[model samples]
Target: MNINSSICNLKFGLFFHLLFLSCSNRDEVKGQIPNVLFIAIDDMLPVLGCYGNSTALTPNIDTLANQGILFMNAYCQVGLSNPSRASLMTGMRPDEIKVWTLKPHFREEKPNVVTLPQFYKEKGYATRAVGKIYHDGAYHQDPVSWSNPSVLSVTRDGRGHKYVLPENYMPKRSKATTTENANVQDTAYIDGKVCQAAIELLNQLTDSTFFLAVGFRRPHLPFSAPKKYWDLYEREMFKKELKNPRRPARAPDFAFHNSNELRGYEDIGELGVIREEKQLELLHGYFASVSYIDAQIGKLIAELKRLGRYDNTIIVLYSDNGFHLGDFGLWGKTTNYEASVNIPLIFCGKGIEQGAINRSMVELIDIYPTLIDLTHGEMKSSHDGISLLPILKGKSSKVKSYALSQIVRPYQDAINSRSPDSMGYSLRTEKYRYIEWRNTKNMSVFARELYRMDDALSEKENIASDIKNEALMNQFSDIVNRIRK
Candidate 1:
C-alpha cells in the first residue's frame, strides 16, 4: 500500500509539469502574432524627407521611418495605378494578370487568386479599408475581407469642419464646372475623410485583431490645393531654372514622349493650350498638395498612438505608384522611366529594425508575401514574388540585383503615331537603366540606353557607342526573355 501511494504522487507531479509546458507553448504562439496597419498614398513620388528630398514637408512619414526600415530603392512593377496596385495585392506581375489598363477589374481578370487582405482575414484579422485602396475609386474592396468598405472624399465626409477654396482656383478652361463644392482644400482632401473613418473603425473594435488599410488621394491631377498650401512654395522660385531637358539618345523616343491626354490638347485650337506661367502654377500646387497630405498623416499617426496600438501594429506606408513631376519634359505617368517606376516603401512595426535603409531592388509584388510571412498567415497559393521578410529584418543581405518595368499603352499604339503599336520593356539596376521598345507585331525597335545614376540627375546618355560596354545590351535582352517567360 505505501509503494502504490508513492507511485501515484510521482504520476501527478509529471502531469502538472506537462500542463505548465502546454500553457507556455500556447502563450508563445499568441505573442508572436502581430496586427497590421497598411497605408497607401496615391500618385506620390519619393519626394519626402526620408528619401533625401529636403523640400518635402513629410514629418509624419519621416518619424515612421525613424522607427522602421525604409526601402530606399523600392519600385513598382508598373507605374500606372491599376497594374501597380493589382500586382502588389495579388503577388503577380502585371503581365501575368494581363492587367495593363485601368478599366478591367482585378478579380475579373484573376478570379481564383488570394489577395493579401484575404489571407489576413483567413488568419482571423478583421480587415477593413477606407478611401482609394484600389485605383480610380471604381474597384471595390473584396467583400469577404473588408467590412464598411468605402472610397470617400473629405469634401463630402459630412464632418463638422468647413472647407473653402479660392474663387480663382478652378482652371479657366476646365470642362468641370466650377461650383461652391467642386474644389476641396488640400488639407481637406479625401485622405482626411479616410483617416476619420479609420478612427471610427478602431473605436468600435473588440477582441478581434484588425487589418486596416488607409488610402490617401491627393496631388494626382489638376493640382488642386488650398491657398495656405500654395503659400508654402513661391512661383518665382520655379522661374529661375527654366531650361530644355534632354534625354538619353539611345533610349527609345517613347521614353521622352508624353501621354495622349497631354497631346490631345494640341488639336483644341488654342483653347486648351497651357501657358508656361500656368504650368509653373500647377507645379506649385503639386508641392502644396504633398505638404497637405503630410499634415493629414500627422493626424492619423496621433490617433494610432492614442489608441495604444502604435507599438503592436505593423505600419507599412507605400505609394500605389510613383508620379512624373515633369521629368524629361514629360508631364505625366505613361512611360517606363525611373521617375515613374520608383516609389517609397517603409515598414515599421514588431520585429522591424529601425533606421535601416535597404538599397536592394524590391518590387510592389513582394509586399503580399512579406505581409503573410510577418503575420504567420497561411500562404494561399504560389506567388511569383518571394517574401521580403528576411530583407526587412536585415537577416538576408539582398533582395534582387535587377528589376523590370513595362508599358502597354493602347492609345499610343494607334496607327501612324511616332511609337505606333508601342510596347516597351525596361530593366533597372543599382547603377544603370536600360530599355527596348517593341510594337504589337513583335518587331524589335531596340534602343539601348545607359545612364549612370551617380552622375547628376541620370541624364539619358547614349553609351551604346562605347565598345567597352557592349555586354549591358545583352544583359537587358536576357532580362526581357526571363520576364516574358
Candidate 2:
C-alpha cells in the first residue's frame, strides 16, 4: 500500500479501537466525552505561587494547582511563540513543521497535517478559539482548527493606548514606553475582552463535547495591565534578588543577543543593558501583568463552575514559551536557557490526581497525544511526542528520559566574514542540559554548552569544556546527533 493508504488503514484501526474503548467506558464517562477547557498563556514563566515563587500573587493559579496535577519540569519545544505554538498544536517539532520564525505559518510547510483542535473537530467535538489561540500575526491563525472563526480584537500597535512613562525617564532605544499601567478597567484590555467572550461562549455552549480554547495575550510585551493590577504590588517588592549576572564565560557568541524584541518599542531608545531602576519597573509591570492574567483565569474558572461544567470538563493550562526578565542580560526568549524554555503546565479534571506535582521531564508536544488519549479520540497521524495519559493516571511515574528544544540563530563567521544560519539543539535530562550549536548551512558543530542541573545558578555556568565532563559530553553529543538526524 501507498503512504496515504497506510495512513488511512492506521486511522481506521485506531477509530474502531477508540470506539470500542469509548463504549466500554461509557458508564465511567457518564455516557459522554468530557469537554475541554484549553487555556493558553503567552510568554509566562513558572512564577506562580504554586510554582514556589512567593513574590508572585497568583491565588487562582495556585488553586488550580491544588485541584490538578502540575508538571514541575515542563519545557517548550522552542523558545519563540510562533514556533512553539505550531509545534505543540501539530504534535510536531519546529524542524518537522519548518516554522522557525514568526513570519511563516505551519500550513505553509505541512498543509495536510491535523492540528490538536482540528483532530478534536474531526472526532465530532465543537472546537472554538478565542484570542491568541495561534500566533496573533498575519496568516498565522489556522482557520480549519476551529468550529467558529477565532475572535481577535487587539491590534499589534500596542492596542492604540498611549503609555505614560515616569518623569525624566529618557529611553535609549525608542521614545515609546515599554509598559502601560492604564487606569482603565479589565475589559479595556484585549485579555479582559477575551475573558468576557469565553464566559459568554461557555454560557451558550450546547454541544456535549466541546473544545474551548481561551488564549491570553499579556505578560508578553509592553507589559500593559490595568492600574489596579499595578497597585497590587509595591514597586520596592519587585527588586531583583540576584544581581544581573554576566553571560556564561565559556558560552558561544551566538547564544546572546541585545534583546531585539524589547528594543523595538519606541520607549526603549538603546540596545544596551537596562539600568537597575528601569529593571525594577519592568519587573513590577511583569508581575502586574501576571496578576492581571491570573484574575482573568479566575473569571474563566468561575464561569466554568457557574455553567456546571467544572467537574466533567478537562482543563489544561499551559504557556507557549517562557520569557526572560534580564536574566543573563537577556530580556527575551530564543536562547537555549532555562528561563526561555521552561514553561508551566497544569492538567485538572476527570481521572487526574489532585494536588500532585510530577517532576518528570515533559515537552509541549506531548499535550496533543495526551488530549487525544484522554478524550478517546483516534489519531490519524504519528506525533513526535508520546501520550502522557499513563503519568496522569498514576500508572507510570515517567514518560521520557529527556526533552529536546531547539533555536535558530544567525552566526557571524570569522573565516568567511559573513553570517550563516545555525541551529542550537538542546537536550534537557534530569540532571544536565547539553546544547550543541551547529552551522545549518554545512552541518558543522560550532560550539557546545553542558550545564550541571544542580540549581538555577548552574544554568549560568558552562562546563562543556571542563576536562571532568569529557565523557558526559561525548555521551550527550551522541544523543544529540541522533536527535538531529
Show the lowest summed lDDT stretch of 10 residues, model 2: 411-420
As a whole number from 0 to 100, the lDDT of residue 169 in candidate 2 is: 33
What would the per-residue lDDT of candidate 1 be over residues 1-485, giving only the tens digit for each residue?
Answer: 69899899989999999999987875555456677888888878888888897566678889989899998778887777777787788888876776666655568768888787887877777888776677754443456546445535223222212223443234343322111232344336455566777778777653447788888776666455556666776777655423234565665564555434444332222233345675566567667777777777777778878877777788889987776655566656766777788888999998888888888888777788788888884455567776788887889857677777777645443212323355667777788776666665665655556666655444567676687777877877787778642
| CA shift of 349, model 1, Å | 0.7
The candidate scoring highest on lDDT is 2
* Cα lDDT for residue 459, candidate 1: 55
Query: Against the true structure, what is each candidate's TM-score?
Result: 0.81, 0.88
